[model samples]
Target: MDKKTHFDFVTSIGLMILSLVMIVDSYRMGVDVGGALYASPGMLPMVLALLLLLTSAMLLKRSIRNGGARQNLAGFVAWFDIFRKSRMAREMMVGALILALYTFVLAPRLPFWMSTSMFMILLMAILKATSLVKNLMITALVVGSIYGVFQMVFHVPLP
Candidate 1:
């Protein structure tokens, strides 16, 4: 089997197993605020577990259909190549840092529109969007849509 497909299969299986473990651990934490007829702390874990299970199944099926051979050390070497590329690795790291920044700095106190617009604009700049006007317009549209969904429909409190 091809290297990428082999890694995909292994990663999917690993994630599924991890999710199952999380489900069990969360279940052991018991329900939230009640013993029965109420959502538990287990709810999120169960949802994650189901998603992981489905994703893993799909990956496994794809690998099988592609006639992937057994993975080996060479497959791991191929996986390591993802880290060898400086540009890709930097992008991945920067994206993760941006997410952390949003969670900690923006989510707490900034107004929904302000913080979202800022984040979206920054994302567009990072992606090297061609046109300034187009980027601004697209960001406006996206922020507006999210604002409508959160404020108008769900009526959720926004920071």
Candidate 2:
């Protein structure tokens, strides 16, 4: 199998797994809540997960038809080497980790403004967007503006 086909095959499988997990979690959230599927909190997510599953299955079928299934274990190992060696891949992985941390960990534990400021600062520093002082100033301005708009203008309480 060629590189593109192999990559597509692996990506399709990963997406399929993710969609399945989403479906399971959504199901666990209670599809029949409020006595109707449409009224359920998980309805939209379940529908979206089903759509993702369908698309990924199609991609998997196409990749296999294009000879992606012919690849051996060594091909998979070689494909992963690009991530290990590429500087861009490392940066992208770090960025994703930071985003996941902000969404799943920090945002829930801290106030919205504090978590957002921290997230922005860390991302700007990692991306080398500017000096520390400038990064802090930008984060402060953005977070403060958002807080002001939501709290004062809209009369919404931020977590």
Which candidate ranks first by lDDT, i.e. highest? Answer: 2
For candidate 2, list the clashing residue pairs, or say none: none
- Candidate 2, residues 6-115: lDDT per residue as tens digits? 77888889999999999999997874465677778888999999999999999889888877465633466787897678999999999999999999999999999889
Worst 10 residues of 2 by lDDT: 67-76
- Over 4 Å off in model 2, which ranges? 11-68
How high is the lDDT of residue 91 in model 1?
79
Q: Could you tell me how far off, in angstroms, the CA of residue 35 lies in candidate 2 after the best superposition?
A: 18
Q: What lDDT tens digits, residue by residue, belong to model 1 across residues 39-151?
A: 67676767778888888888877875665435534565676776767797887777777777777998777887888888778777777875888989998998888889988
lDDT of 2 at 39: 77
What is the lDDT, from 0 to 100, of the residue 136 in candidate 2?
98
What C-alpha lDDT values do all the predictions have?
Answer: 0.75, 0.88
- Cα lDDT, model 1, residue 42: 70
Q: By TM-score, how accurate is candidate 1?
A: 0.50
Ten contiguous residues minimizing lDDT sum, candidate 1: 67-76
